[model samples]
Target chain A: MTIRIAAVGDIHLSEHARGTYRAHLDGIDERADVLLVAGDLTRHGTVEEGQVVVDEFRDLGIPVVFVLGNHDYHSDAEQEIAAMLRTAGMYALDDSAEVLLDGRLGVAGGKGFGGGFAGKCASEFGEPETKAFVRHTREIADRWRIALKGLDTDHRIVLSHYSPVKETLAGEPPEIYPFLGSYLLAEAADAAGADLIVHGHAHAGTEKGVTPGGIRVRNVALPVLGRAYAIYCLGGEEL
Target chain B: MDIWDPPHYVAARVQRAIAEDERTNELGIRVDIRGDHLFLQGQVCEEDQRERVAQVAAEAAPGMVVHNEVICVAVGEPGEQEVL
Candidate 1:
């Protein structure tokens, strides 16, 4: 059975965006079985913007899963936005796991964080502030590792707002790579295992990449894809 | 135009304002200053947002000529399906 997974991120919707973005999703049900919104559903991360997200994403007639991006946390309303989306019958993942397609597919994810990649990444050895920054990514990675391990579904995908590997962030300036994503995320998924890792937050990044462990990673940020969404088919006789 | 703030600093300030200003909280826009001209490049979801970014950049650096090169992101249809 092939699971058609439609994904996009960095929608950046707001009150001004009402009735503008949803038109792209017309008849999405026919194209894919599920839609996974990687993150950045709002512009300023305001509660009002959260309502816009709910209105646009709700009643899509398919399982729509979401994770918050940094832009969605700008106003410190990430929890409220997630809660509101949940109340609207959407699945919101925060360093957690959700099984869809009747336990056939499991997605584990959160916003993810940035600390750099591999040897170029940050470390815990430093001042309290520096340590905290790197530690934040480490802790999120730990939770994801645990989440991926607990998922018993046939297919597991990790959704995040930050890039897990440098390959997907090719267009972004090399200087800002640390702020874009960290290798720790890829390490976690590699340790626990997953079919794919989907992320955003890299507006200029490319659409496809693979982790050092050979797991596929794709950046579905709207600007990167230049499309409303990208569909990836998993677990079929073709495979 | 202050002697203490160089063109680089002006670019940085405009970039920061574009990201931090409530009127235009766009993170992906890049600001560059060449001579007396300030160039703004990147993509926004809407045309109005692009104008607002230029407005914010102009306000940040009063004397420079603001060139808004940012384009509206055209989100087309879901193209093809990639089988994994």
Candidate 2:
């Protein structure tokens, strides 16, 4: 069977652009079977923003799989937003996994960590504050790795808001690499053997690449760079 | 011996494709493709649009397995970003 996956990330929608997905979503018909968002659905994480996101997905042709970003919890209303998202039929994943494309696709979601980028990333061997940052990122990576391993489907996709590898982050400045992404996340995806991984957050980074394990990775931050959504297919004889 | 066989695995060709990628002055889609796998690398204009690039590249490969790893590089700093 041919399954099309359409994904985008970092679409910072607000009350003004409520239901923004209503218009451009038509591409889904000619494009994909499910939608994967790479986080940052709101200008400021709030129930209102979550509602807007939910409303936008109300018309999506297929199931919507999503993960939250730092912004999604800006107001510390992550739980409220997550609840409303579930009510709206949107899977707001947080260190979680779900089936999509009518169970043809196995997807895991996590907000991810930003201890910077590869070669310039953070380590867990510093002071309390520094160790906490590095360890925190490690925790997220560990959870994501566990979730990816738990997926039982033909094609597994990991959704995150931060990057996992430097190959995918060619354009971001080296200095801010630590806060932009980390090699740890990619390590998790690699170890878990996921088929593909998608993320946002590095708006200045490039748009395509791979993990050391050769799993696919894409950065889908909308505001910083975008034209429309992307479409990819899997589990076919052609591939 | 086959324990490490990859999904849509085409190790031989992907290595050659990436090696040739260094010669391109323009962002050519064919070179960006690995083996039969596709990876969208380099700078892009906006966030979500990077998705389209991957789609187009995959479509161009016609049955080649695709693995999108496209990151979104901001065009400018946060507030400095104006209507482009």
Candidate 3:
């Protein structure tokens, strides 16, 4: 059976965004089997902002899974944000995997960091600060790989907040590539043989791309999609 | 006569301009200088805000070319409404 996934990211929900999404997201459960929020669920990582996002999805009646974004860490309340979402019946994953649809689909998620792409990326061989910066991404990428490896479902979906490949980040400025995402996340997903990869964080990026292993990568940032959400039917059509 | 580094001077001027502007201050715009070029990067809520930010940067750095990399997001109106 094909699993319909409705995904979007970078909602950046704030206090003012309390009721903005419900109207746009109405009937999502009837449209898709599951909802995947790629990240940036809050504007500044406040519990109140997180509450706004949770309120929108509280009665969506579908399994909602999400990862945290860089913006969600702005106020250092990421833990509270995740807790708020979880309390509202959403699965907030960070370097973890969850099986859904009665073991039909497995989602591996991580708030992937940025360190540029291959051939022009940063390395851990530089100064202490540079090493730490690159190392953080490396750790998250490694966790992502491990999480995907642990999934035992029929379809594997890798979800993240940062773009895994440069293909989806096309419209974003090339100078900010290092800060937009890292290629390591792509390598991990490709090696793990994912059916689909969903991410956000690149607002100016394109919507679609492919991994080296031919897995489909999508940037579902709200601005890029030009809609409240997008539905992608995985395992039904060959990409 | 006071000597000024073109890029640094432009960066400082643009920073002050953005900070002093009510409409752009909360946008968190970042200014970078490369030689005589000034790069503005950030997200603004509206199209006019993007233009305003670029215009402010250009005016702050008169002789430098401004590269406006600011992205404008069309966020819908925010208010309380009945949940469906």
Question: By DockQ, who's the top model here?
Answer: 1
Ranking by lDDT: 1, 3, 2
| Model 2 chain B poorest ten-residue lDDT run | B75-84
Worst 10 residues of 1 chain A by lDDT: A230-239
Relative to the unseen true structure, what is the C-alpha lDDT of residue A119 in candidate 1, on a scale of 0 to 100? 81
**Candidate 1 segments whose C-alpha is farther than 4 A from its true place:** A237-239, B1-4
Model 2 misplacement above 4 A: A223-225, A237-239, B1-84
lDDT of each: 0.94, 0.69, 0.82
Question: How far does residue A128 in candidate 2 sit from its true spot (Å)?
Answer: 1.7
Candidate 2, residue A178: the lDDT equals 75
Q: Write the per-residue lDDT of candidate 2 for residues A67-157, one digit (tens) a residue.
A: 8887787778988888888887778889889977666789986888878655666777858999999988899888988888888887888
- Cα RMSD over interface residues, candidate 3: 10.9
TM-score of 3: 0.81
Residue A31, candidate 2: how far off, in angstroms? 1.9
What are the runs in model 3 whose C-alpha is more than 4 Å off?
A: A237-239, B1-84
Clash pairs (backbone) in predicted model 3:
A116-A178
Predicted structure 2, TM vs. truth: 0.71
| Fnat for each predicted structure, in order | 0.87, 0.00, 0.04
Docking quality class, candidate 3: incorrect
